[model samples]
Target chain A: MKAVTAFAPATVANVSCGFDILGFAIGDMGDRVKVSLSDQPGLRVVSITGDGGRLPLEAEKNTCTVAIQAFLDRLNANQGLDISLMKGLPLGSGMGSSAASAAAALMAVNELMGTPFTKTELVPFAMEAERVACGAAHADNVAPSILGGFVLIRDYAPLDIVKLPVPEGLYTTLIHPHIELRTADSRSVLRRQISLQDAVVQSGNIAGLISALYTSDLKLLGRSLKDVIAEPYRALLIPGFYELREAIQKAGALGSGISGSGPTLFVLSESREIAAAVAKVSEEVYAKIGLGVDVSVAEVNPIGAYVIESV
Target chain B: MKAVTAFAPATVANVSCGFDILGFAIGDMGDRVKVSLSDQPGLRVVSITGDGGRLPLEAEKNTCTVAIQAFLDRLNANQGLDISLMKGLPLGSGMGSSAASAAAALMAVNELMGTPFTKTELVPFAMEAERVACGAAHADNVAPSILGGFVLIRDYAPLDIVKLPVPEGLYTTLIHPHIELRTADSRSVLRRQISLQDAVVQSGNIAGLISALYTSDLKLLGRSLKDVIAEPYRALLIPGFYELREAIQKAGALGSGISGSGPTLFVLSESREIAAAVAKVSEEVYAKIGLGVDVSVAEVNPIGAYVIESV
Candidate 1:
């Protein structure tokens, strides 16, 4: 098969109630991976760019090549592939950058082949690759990266993941400060177990947020998007986290929360105007702390893991 | 200013994962309460029927009348009134029978008093009345009875509840065994402060269920409905609980679980035909178990508490 380049969007995992089980893909901010079938029987990593000399170029250590090899191994077919990683998304930025690379590489290689697996079936393989990068097999990022839109990782074993429909007019404002925090380091700050009372409250909030999402009741969504478990512990890492959230809420954003693992925050709004308003407030809040940030006003991209280019 | 009669549908609290936070109203099974603005100096409970003589006749002890008093208190005005409870739904049937009475009374009185409170404000009053009956403040039954569809009780204080759009084409099959289980008796069976591990699993299941409901994935909904916390202990109260669930599942119901506190098993199906089929299987299962049962197969009654008779 000819060479193909694909893009997998950045995902917001641990979406309040979903924990490691839910994710949604961003339509605009993501990474691209290029894959081509090789005549040789050994997988090879071609190059890695746009990562500021941080990512490893070794085929085994690299997330993209490891994901591609896992995809090939799943089919019991020994096929060589040349993989290139163009990391448009920042690494360790809490925007699901690593997961997007892993998902994109696996998807690109699968498409270059005859497509031997279903989208649902391929998630585990992609998640395995994510584990190589993050030391955990979590589907929140991989599911949305591969399937697109809102996804629920219903089960890890026997791999039941669901891609739910995003409500109409759904837009997101993503604010990323120029700060890096490893997913492992960020996860280490969390308590191994929370109190049952707190868990119940968190679970209720999560369930309520999802119910609001389905019903398209923006007010309820805003009210229910509270995170009693992860947010309280993790918010200390980002400067002006509380102020930014307050500003976002004041600007009429339905809800705002930490994006995945950290310097990035996401606000789900009903329109570009509201998103822009949220972005403005968020930028102002961050600027007060003397931080430069990139804010992307994007929509929930329904179509995930698509071919970006072919050569 | 005049007399009005209203009915609110029965509901199931602890909707699988929601424990005490979610509920939906049944269209056909409910209690009718009539309220009349009278020239009398104090509220009067004139009659109670269809309750097997188990309910209290005193206005202070009755669930419906307590709801009426709460409604009156919210207005900060004391008014004399006459209330009659037409106990259409069976009492102590684990089908939110008491909640229906409380909700019905609130609806009837609200309309009778010229609509001073919105449905959102009315839930706490209804829940308060339910507390008088069940010994705790719970909104699962009251919220749905008042709002008419699937309700996620995000918060009880200041009364934040989210009404989710019921998945389209959904139908319900309920099997009410001749046996009765009191809400108080069921409450005594629970252990306070469950393990944190168990709570996490339960919360995860609840989140999955909410996602499934939103996505309208019947299979996911069925799979996600497994309750690890309350159902295991309560299932022993219902005869043929596991067996009936199996039979109904085989007979085309997506899933079946103990409704509210006991004696009643509810099934969710995609279509009316499937719902009927599941109901038949449920009836057969109960019959083979040598138990008398009443099977009611109905679609989700979208309309909630409303005035059934005008003055």
Candidate 2:
């Protein structure tokens, strides 16, 4: 094959109760990467679009290219490649934008290279790009984006992960407020320590939340959505974050919390009617505050990243 | 019906990953409380046995009587009750001795009163007893003792709880070292606060553990049995505790940690053979330390407190 095109979906990490450990892939909105073979002996970025020229055109500096470079190094392949980036996800939007790019590029390269890897085998490669995105080796976003559905990154030392169940009919409402909050800056606002009581409560919620997912008990999951550690500290950076959370709760959201870092509020509901109502509430909350917002309703994506075709 | 007898199974609370919210009922080793009508107008303890005369016997001071009193108050029942306490579980042994007594007493009293309360409805009453047992009103022990199997206390504000699925073939190995470490004393050794990193890691483990239970992933569950909060402080109180944990891990146990507070070490294995091996490790550790040990292997008890017979 001379060329391959692949798409990777967006994901919601943290999910209220699980700050750094839990996330689920969501929506059709994602990034598409196009790869073509070249006579040259090294990878090159031909052009990048849909990101307003903000992303790097250099292969070494870009997130997707970083993942592709890692993949090539892992396989010891020396084929030259030309790449095009179509950024469907917003930058610093807390929507796993970097993860999508990295995942998509990795998928396209793997397809162009005759599919030497499974979908899950590409996570570490994409994480090399995620490290560049957030300056942390966290896999909450990349895991779900690569593996699909829900994922729990149990521990990072050995890269331990477990794929959690996602109940049917569950809908996610993402209200991305047009604001800037870098993942690094949002993370910097958190405390280095927390009260033991807070830790216990957070631990209970994570357990309860995971249990609810397996059993399809939405009410218990909603009640267990409290984040006693991160949300309390990071909510300050997102204007009206608390108000939107409360409004969504009243509007029938199962649970509501910040998506990844901030500026985007994620609400979960069982039905699209309630999810649409939740989206309306978030839109009104941001509109009242004079901030533009993009609202979306998504079900859990059963598949993470995939190839479109090869020619 | 004038007389009733009930048995409440012993429980291993904390369960490693779940500090304040998780526990499971064990084998037939438990407490038996026999209740009968008395001429006295108020609840009273007619006799006490099998505790080596160490536990409080006063109706007001006893954990079982406290639960009975609460059950009566909740139901507005004015009947007087005479209670006999048969302490099959040890006092201050981290085997949920107080909870077994409380659960047994509540079950006997409820049965004597025509079974007005459900097993779960008796948790708060048992928790009242728990407050007298330890200075804390936590229900990690009482919930499992009442509801059976594995129970997760999702929250305590409204007393939300869920019964977790225990995979078939899961076995529990417990060794109670002949030592005394009161729940209050063991609890006092913990720090009032914890670092955020520890909290995050602990939360991940709890989530992973619950996921493992639902999915029957033994290796994942074993890896998830970590306690960064209580075990560190409480391990100092249990002689050879760390060595037993290490030994059990080497003996093919899935996971091992403190049972509830201290003075008892618990290990989980997938079969009776492996559990027997784990128990051998525990017995050897305690015996080498010149301390008497009582070790037992148990399947996950599917029932907690129950009526022994109909009157």
Candidate 3:
């Protein structure tokens, strides 16, 4: 029997002004999936762990199992796999929970099948799996979770992914608010139309953010983190978001904004000290609001989805 | 007695995906301004040339002369200068004719006054002068013309300008059709509102363009040059623009788009050979329609406004 196990890192998508175009992976927080050859002749969900029964047990409804099914369907092979998902990250925490599971399953399956497809070639399977969770095949989360570091979805249709270098010393602080905010509900909060003036400013900010990352200009990055289009509409949904953002800024964060469709918020800084400081500020602000939050400081994940066990 | 003459190169703004935020300097085509001490108590215009008597001879109305006055006002100096304007570029050609004049005049005046300001510091003075011609202070043309190379205006409020490196062997082909395209008219053609979906796509393109520039990935640069907002609305004003763009692409151009406000189109290529070929295609496309167009082949201008003569 052929068997493989893979790990994919958690990612933060819609990074400030980039909306659906930019994302970055972080830390060791992710999902572990084990794929083994199955005699059932179809994809099967053998088991799932760590998700607190939030995810579906059925293979057809699960993101990781669906990704494996899609991968086999694309290959036009009758070969099937049994998938076991370990969700280290929480569902709808704005930390690419679904994307990690999807990417890890695909990676494990690809390795079990002798790695016929390239890593980039597996992006589609992961994106399709996102459809099962978010009702859209969005690649912002999956691309970085699979490929690592900073990833840019240059264009969605046909899906052009550009891997950007994350400058050394850049650290991130993720504050998971322990509140439930569905990705679909957060997406629906945004207005369909925006003023031209707002769009122009947003465009400049996006360019500025990319330049900041490449040139290592943290001050510019902080100033360029204004998200007029989405933030103004979604700020009310995330309780104490503005207060947490203010506290984070006071603590010298490079920038702070909503992490994907958030109740979870993320802050970027140049050092672990700053990240820790920002996390403290975030925890204090959330504590005042009678809310519990989980904080982690980590560098950008350099390696994305990778094999842990192969036979 | 002190005097100085300066040359400010013409600039191309709105580099496809950037709209009002990005610009680059190009070519020998520029404005020549000579500023000499008058020993009088205030500013005066000596003479104007090459403009067919279109530009203002009075110090108050001329863009270059206005910049000098603003510079002196900031300095709180009573010194006076006689200015001679030599317009090497045509006005309203979408080639930054006014900005070149303003930058050159400021450079000459600053040198004659023993240089109280840095080149980057002179950007606002030149931008302020743009108000004389375009009815608004826009720095996209003036910043690049004054600073040289590629420039990104991250924000207009605090005036954060980023100087981007120009990759080696990148050449430009500019086609000026001698048609009238006022800056305000081109701006007026665009809708005040844009869909969020379109805004997201435009934001992605801007990020992609900046990434491509830094990475020196010419193919990625070409692919990222889509203008979803400005070009679609402004293309109607430029006759045969679509066909000419197609021809330039066929001739191995990296990307082609309407420069600045319109009536001028610019194409980027990897080599001078490709630029010349693209220019030839541009000329032929305009010639077939009984329009006489001026074509210029140039590399990214490394030096912006500078002193030609100082004593």
Candidate 4:
């Protein structure tokens, strides 16, 4: 066996109405990882860069290395591998930085070892990798980062996942404010028990969003994708949440919501032009709020993890 | 113009997991309403029947009559309608008997008056009629009864609705127990608030159901169409809820749940034979539990609410 390296883009989970179940892949922001066969009998993470010296280099704590180890263990392969992660996206920025690294590592390792695991099989392992950092098993980020486009994790039990068709002309505007809110912290603020009435409303909203996605109606998609349960409670943690939303709405975003946990807000639009417009609008709003932010307009990347430049 | 009568089948709301937003029209159980131009101007409901003498004859209290009256009032016409309703499905009882009557009456009168309103416009009016019964404006039952097929009500503000494609080879078995549970009485048993955690799980299930339905995967449909929020709370009112579900599962129902509110249960299957098998199994179970129940196997009536003979 020889060495292999791959890259997987960052992802945005929840997608406004589909919290914990739905996600989309973003092409522009991601992480890169390299994996090489090692003579040693156990896995080892060699190095990591571009993560502000935040991510651990330990085998168990590093998301990329942990995910690769789990994937190899699942395959019952005793082979060891050395991994190097170049994290383009930052940690704790709610941009799925950990998920990207995990996906890249899993893909690189899987490919190097005769490609034993399918993308679906790699998802849970990747989520496990994410859990090393976030302290929980969740697939909203990993599913899209692995499968690409929009992915729905129907059930985790038998591992049922369904990929919904991307609505035509869908573009995204992502604004990452230079603030950090960990997924664990955001999750802790949520109430454990909610009113049954509120659950009914939230369920209705979810059904609407799924239907709108299938029907390809942008207007309905905007109207349907509402998070009465999570956004209200978590929005306070993000600075200028209301103003950014208002600006996005005014700039012709079909809909806008917090991207995953706080610090990153996303706007879904129909075209690159509108997406660019939204990016400009978001920049202005962040400026008004006295927060520095990075904005990008990316299409829904249909292809997930793959070797962009094969060695 | 001569007086005309119209009939609309009753609908089951919630349909197990899809609370406040999903419904389907059922034949052989519903309401019959007669509408005619009245001499005394404005709308007046003259008679009512088949309701065990529980329904009021006054226009203000009658749901079917109120829908027609609202339609006429919107037109600002001096003309009025005289309505006579023959209700077959019990009021509330989880079956949308009142919604059917309201939808049917409004439909028939609209035809007689040259259809002053579209089907979309008629939905809210029918929902308004439902409000007269349940004290809340909801459109799950009325939308299906009016537009037919499985309906996805995206949003109520702009009245965005999508008619989802009913999967092929789908059959249903409905078991109506000879017990009555009014919508008001059943709704009163529910708690006002719910946990956000439960909401996320239920939303995931609903998304799975939509995907399963679209893909025509019956097994996935069976697995995904689960109600975690409302079923556990409301199942207590239905006799033999446990035994009946178990029996149907044994008999080969893809899935089963409380029909709308209570006292009625619905089973989904792949074929009529399977549906009949499920019905037979449920009948024995209900009989053993000392609940007299009527069971019927029917395909999902894709064409909703049309004239049986001629227009």
Which candidate leads the pack in lDDT?
Answer: 3
Worst 10 residues of 2 chain A by lDDT: A130-139
Where model 3 places Cα greater than 4 Å from the true spot, the runs are none
Q: Is the docking of candidate 3 incorrect, acceptable, medium or high quality?
A: high
Model 2 lDDT per residue over A12-119, tens place: 898787998998899798999999999998889998899988998888789888899999999998889999999999888888989999989999999899889987
TM-score of chain A of each: 0.94, 0.97, 0.97, 0.95
A1-311: candidate 1 lDDT, tens digit per residue:
57989998998887765555668999777889999878887878778889998998888888887777787787788877888889988777777888899888877777788777777777888877788888888888888988998887766656677677678898999899877766667777777666646666776887876766676777777777777777788888888888888888888888877878777888899899999999898788878889899998999888888777666
Candidate 2 chain B least-lDDT 10 residues? B302-311
Ranking by lDDT: 3, 2, 1, 4
Q: Per-residue lDDT of A1-311 in model 3, one digit per residue for the tens?
A: 38899999999999989888999999898999999997778888889999998889898789998888889889987886788999999887889999999999999999988897988889999988999888889999999999999899999776889998887888999998878877678888899989988998999999998998898887888889889899887889888988888888889898877888897787899899999999898889889999889999999897899999987
Q: Candidate 1: what lDDT?
A: 0.80
Model 4 over residues B1-311: C-alpha lDDT tens digits?
Answer: 55767777767678766776677766556677778876786667788888888888888888987787677678876676678787877765666777888888877887788867777788887877878877877788888887776777656776766677788888888888888777667777777776666677788888877767677778878988788877887788887888878888888888877777777788888998999998888778877878788888877766655443223
Q: Top DockQ: which candidate number?
A: 2
Q: Which pairs clash in model 4?
A: A193-B195, A194-B193, A194-B194, A194-B195, A195-B193, A195-B194, A196-B193, A196-B194
- Give candidate 2 misplaced runs (Cα > 4 Å): none
**What's model 4's lDDT at B301?**
63
TM-score of each: 0.89, 0.97, 0.97, 0.94
**Per-residue alpha-carbon lDDT of model 4 for A44-91, expressed as tens digits?**
878888977887888888888789878877877788778889888877
